[model samples]
Target: MRIAVISDIHGNVKALKAVLDDLAHQAPDAIVNLGDCVSGPLWPEETAVLLRDLGWPTVCGNHDRVVAAGNVPQDNRTDSFTEAALSAESLDWLRRLKPAIRFSDEIFLCHGTPRNDDAYLTEVIDGRGSARTADEADILHRLDGEKAGLICCGHSHLPRVTHLPASGQTVLNPGSVGLQAYSDATPTPHVMANHSPHARYALIEEIKGTWTFILRAIDYDWQSAAQTAAANSRPDWAHALATGRMQDGA
Candidate 1:
């Protein structure tokens, strides 16, 4: 089985379209969307419509839940923008999304941790209270003994593949398709950065019961993507979309 995975498409239709165009060529057996689908100042409605049409297996994300529940973060102006941008139908669809998906007996998909939609599955907070790569034992602890051949997750907006030599379970994060960088306060204030304006995703192919993975960062019209953010008064998101780097000191 070949699976194409995407996550954190925070309302940037341009980036999502670019990634989907690339996927058209790859023709993976299944396409999995890891959510955080539309919670930015960009084209939320358009992005939601496109995904609805594509009809892929999707899991709910933290941002999606906030919006679906009409609980936009108090400090997050982007969430307010998203709430207004999405239609009632789109919000309803997001509200009904599964928190996790078992694509097959071998493969599982989730936005964050399998148990907590908000928890980081393979990342952890450091002594500084900032998120960072987790140790093998820590990762395993978070897994809580759930064993699948492949566990796919997102939410840190960082692309990574970890093969637990002990469990033979591979955890893959496809990274962010939109919003390349953002500062978060959960698990302590920290920033997530891709460091380049590229649409990111991943392809996993099962070969003889083993897995081969490819991480993709496809270039798109990031300038326009940034411009949209700027136009909507989210210069922070604009900077990230343009350079994939947080605005200096942001």
Candidate 2:
């Protein structure tokens, strides 16, 4: 079985369209979304509508939860923008999403960690916002004894595939389909950047009892997306959309 995995769209519909176009050719057996779908300065309602129509298996992301709850903090401008843009129907759809999905007996999906949508599963972010791949022990600890052969997650928005030798489980993060880079002030002050404005996703296939995967970064009209962000009064998002890098010092 082959599956396409996408995550962290963050409301950039142009990027999402580009990814859908790419997927039309790849044509995997199934598609799964790891959430963080519509929380940006761009087209939240439109993105949500498209996702709802597609009807892919989806998980609720941390931002999705924030938007669905309708109690966004004043400081969270992204979630606030999304909340204002989404209609009641869109918000309800988000509210109904689950934090995790067992796609199959061998496949498990989550937006971040299994127990925490806001936590990182495969990456560790320092207090300064720099991120590094977590060690095997750390990843296992975060897994909390999840026994699925294939574990998929997104949140860090970095494309990665890790194989845990001890448990023989593979973890895949397909990266961000929309916002490739951003700065966040959460558990710490930090930035996540891909260093290039490419829409990213992953395709994984199980064959003959082994799993193989590919991480893809597809080109799209990022300049238009950047201009949309700037028009929405988010110059930081514009910079990230255009250059896939945070402005100097962010």
Candidate 3:
């Protein structure tokens, strides 16, 4: 069986379409979306409509929850913009999404850690406001004793594949499809950058009880997306869209 995984769209339908085009050629048996579906300066309602039509198995991300709640703080421009742009129906769709999904006995899907949508799963924020790959002990602790052989999560927007040698379990993060780089200040001040503006996703296949996976980055018209962000008064998002880095030096 083969499954394609996408996450953290954060609007920007252009990137989503590019990923979809790539997936058409890849032709996986199933597709799953780890959310953060539409919360950015880009086309939230349009992206939400497209995702609703696709109807892929999806989980709610932190941004999804914030946008759906519509009680966004004034300082949260991303969620506030998304909340204002989304229709009532779209908000309802996000509200109905689950935080985690048991795809199968062997596969578990979640936006972040199974316990917390706002927490990082495979990475940790350091003292210098940067992200570092989490050690095995930390990763296992975050797993919280979930026994699925294959675990899939997103939130850090970094593409990674980790294997726990002791338990023979694997964790996969397909990365962000729309916005690739971002800065956060919740748990700590930190940034995540893919270092290039490319839409990302992952494909995993199970053969003879062994699971294999691939992380993909596909090129798209990021310049246009950046322009859209700038027009929406989010130069930070524009820079991330154009360069996949939070700033000039990042």
Better of 1 and 2 by TM-score: 2
* Worst lDDT 10-window in candidate 1: 124-133
Expressed as tens digits, the lDDT of each residue in 32-100 for candidate 2 is 999999999989999999999999999999999999999788788899999999999999999999999
TM-score of each: 0.96, 0.98, 0.98
Q: Which residue pairs does candidate 3 place in steric collision?
A: none
The local lDDT score (0 to 100) that residue 40 gets in candidate 2 is 95
Relative to the unseen true structure, what is the C-alpha lDDT of residue 81 in candidate 3, on a scale of 0 to 100? Answer: 92
The CA lDDT at 3 in model 2 is: 94
Worst 10 residues of 2 by lDDT: 180-189
lDDT of each: 0.89, 0.94, 0.94
Worst 10 residues of 3 by lDDT: 241-250
- What does candidate 2 score on TM? 0.98
- Cα deviation at 194, candidate 2, in Å, is 0.8
